[model samples]
Target: MTSFLPTDEEREFIEVAKGFALEKIRPIAREVEDNRIVNDKMVKELEELGFLSREMPEEWEGLELPLISQAQILQALSYGDLAVIQGLPGAGDAASFIRLQKDHPILSLHKEELIQSNKTIALLDLLEVANSQITIEKTENGWMIDGVSQPIRLASFADYVIVAAKDNEGVPVVLWVDIYQDQVKVDSGDYRLGLLASGTGKIIFDQVQISKQLALAEAEDAVKLMADTRNRIRVLQAAKQVGLMEAALDYATEYTAGRKAFGQEIAKFQGVSFRIADMAMETRIAAHLVWEAALAVDGGKNTAAGSSIRALYRAHRSLRFVTDSAVQLLGGHGYVQEYPVEKWMRDAQAQVTLYGRERELLIERGEQILSGAIGVTV
Candidate 1:
């Protein structure tokens, strides 16, 4: 089957991204896994390549590329290193939120900062917010936030943190707090099985005070904003997963063709060859599912449903099948840390789970479908 190919511009960007990954990111993947930190050199190179700002509006110091273009870029970068490339430099998601809420007063204060800052910004992920235990209180000076947020992606590298908390009335409140404040504490050295270089950490906010102007969204608006942003992130994540699956399939195919078993190449066996074929077929399906969702988001169609289907497809089935099968084909070599297929498996699992627990997402998607709430977004 002829899968959709990238446009000329997108192909150019992919090549540039691939070169950057091989030259800059791939060399340090092991070092990052060992050290559990993303170095400044990689961050600088990503910035120089204009990756973090690829989707931001021109007025906000972004390239304002189409969402599909951003997805392609992410896939290319993830082909190099998913962890460091996923959300580095800053909270591009926060920028997207700000873009969605341009009329909000909080955006006025942070517009330039969101665009021009060299420091990364961390947005509290909705999936993991329950662990954060955040609450907001109205004070004479402004709003006070208190909570402990665990395993926030890139919070250690972030100069600013964007949080979505609830007020006494249970209304959602979005707050942008400076990480250097006296009340903020970050335990940045935590380790993980995958995405070790994400700089994930535990953050404690003790009576952090910010002006009322920092409250970015509330009530139903905040809920909707979160849903929208989740869908947006899912699209990019699906694209990255496609890259991971494809890379794994490619590596395994090459390995099986060359490696010998019973005095013959393993690829000669029907069982092994069939599995490779299945991996290719599944990877193609995953890629197309991602594109379907991305095109929906780009066209402002039924994004919620489209994104949900994309997430369900990749998280529940496709990636797991591809990565696990790749491992099976590689046998002992796949399990070794020296070969990257094992790392890819771990990374793929971690990413798919980031949106939510698979069981819960499965139920939610089913409910959405049964309710007929899902439209023909694609």
Candidate 2:
């Protein structure tokens, strides 16, 4: 019964986002990446457009758009530049947690600041419990967070951080930390790959003591919340990847159609045309998977988590293929800095690394299916 067609309001929002992305975001993408920051003016514009608060609850002066609507809008915006969309100042990935637990006591305390200020929140998700350097220990009255986190988007400028990790005893917990009060240090790295405009950096927590009041959830509640939050994040991120894929696909198609090689347009050649067809197929597949995942999450289905994992894994795979195909199709011009295909290819790779490993996601989905936690249809 799920409909693929977007509602009138959703279509309007997508059109507006698409226009702003091409007109405003695409033009300054290089400048933003070069400066390693999204300027305040652009951030204000995004805020005015309600892009920054799309996932937040209406009670907190946010749009509280459904996952499907948000996914389409985000895909449209990110079509211009994924890094710029990521770098925009706002709640960042923590928006998913806020949307899931809108009325939590800890979140309620910060509701005013979140609604009134442009302060951003970075999420350090250590729930994977593999290849993580961050260590969490339960204390007498609270918990102590130590070690440095991997490069997380928005870490460089985040005013707050949400940690979703298991303690030394392996009890899952979610905690919020005030970056300034806790003296969390942002370790900026020499990132040359992609997402340069994103506030990508490591956060150092040297024996940071988080009181019990800051613990958003613990034990079973924390596990459930983290699962739902991660699913939502995966779906949204997959939507963004789909956007980048479409951008690369379209750019490559146009380049091939115009650039002459032998005696005519290169697109006339089978090699070039075949690759374009493949890129288009990959993009369409990724888009459909992301949309399905978004709808599953919005519907609060039991299979939502598995669907999200499948969507993201496919998105990661297809994004890399499509972007690389774009570069390959453009030949020499694709490798040069003057063209945007190279940047898109780099961004696609960086995005895949940051979100989740493709193999891991696939394995997780497989396990979910075998365990009967999610049906094969998902």
Candidate 3:
């Protein structure tokens, strides 16, 4: 069974993050909601507090905390404000890549501080893919990147993008290029049902320069990188869902326990109490699935629960069901912005779509499982 419970020090770290979330993030969530842009000051504060790079190692100017601990803290932070920083695992994922890919040039070039912040930020920004055709052709200088990248997270905020574009040889190559010229635009079209912190911006790059050091080595690594990163973030996302469901449960419990309806506390009603019971049950399932995914990945037990299959799949599905129940239990209050459950529900919806489409992911997994050429552990 998967478990993400923290040890003594880890618990302390989570408590600190919780305090920051409650004191700072929660208060300004609504303000960001109204303004439709994350406050730069908050981003600076989060960076200054080392909240953005908590899981990176001391070698990279981070705490190198346990993955489980980082998940817990991120869960709390999302509860405070889902709109500001919904993507939480990039710090940890960057640290893992740097630690694993010893000879990688990307890690070799940056200073320690920039290694923690800039590199991680770059990886985080790559979440935007709007069917952009990437062309990476060898040039006299190095490589020229010509393609239209689709709506990306933090598109307006990022100076460069870590892109997986096709090469002249028809190889799906990866490159990092500046986002200058070529009509960079954001589609602030309609407020998403949730996850307001993300700026859905469509990126266009016309004849941008790419250095060899920044491009990923192989055509296949792009797919692997995306799958690897999703598994990492899935655990953290599940943890945040825990916080969201917990908050919603607390809200429902309080309202039902005191608010009288039909001459009785709503909590006294069997229907209300039963829904709470279901929430509790599903929350446990989600927690177990998330922890299973994290430990399985870290321990190299990928066949059992990693590779974005077993545990991540369970966690994502559980997140959807649990948040839906929470929203329903709260009735109309759950739908309005006045209550935080509505925000949590909206954020959960975005989580479903963030890394990749759930439909495509399932199809890919099915095709892999059905292909009998390679040995796979069930």
Task: Please name the candidate that would achieve the greatest lDDT relative to the true structure.
Answer: 2
TM-score of each: 0.88, 0.97, 0.82
Q: Give each model's whole-structure lDDT.
A: 0.73, 0.90, 0.61
lDDT order, best first, reads: 2, 1, 3
Candidate 2 displacement at residue 265 in angstroms: 0.9
1-378 per-residue lDDT for model 2 (tens digits):
768789898899999999998999999988998998989999899888888889988888889988888889989999999999988887888989998899999999999988888679999989875878889899999999999898999998899999999999999999999999645799988888999988899999999999999999999999899999999999899999999988998899888898887799999999889889999999899889899999988899887988899889999999999999999998889999889999999998889888878888877888888988767876
Better of 1 and 2 by TM-score: 2
Better of 2 and 3 by lDDT: 2
2 against 3, candidate with superior TM-score = 2
Best by TM-score: 2
**Model 3, 43-91: lDDT tens per residue?**
7778777787765656666676555676677767765766666533243
Instruction: Identify the runs in model 3 with alpha carbons over 4 angstroms from their true place.
Output: 1-3, 87-103, 112-144, 165-170, 181-191, 211-213, 219-227, 304-307, 372-378
Which of the predicted structures, 1 or 3, would earn the higher TM-score when compared with the native? 1
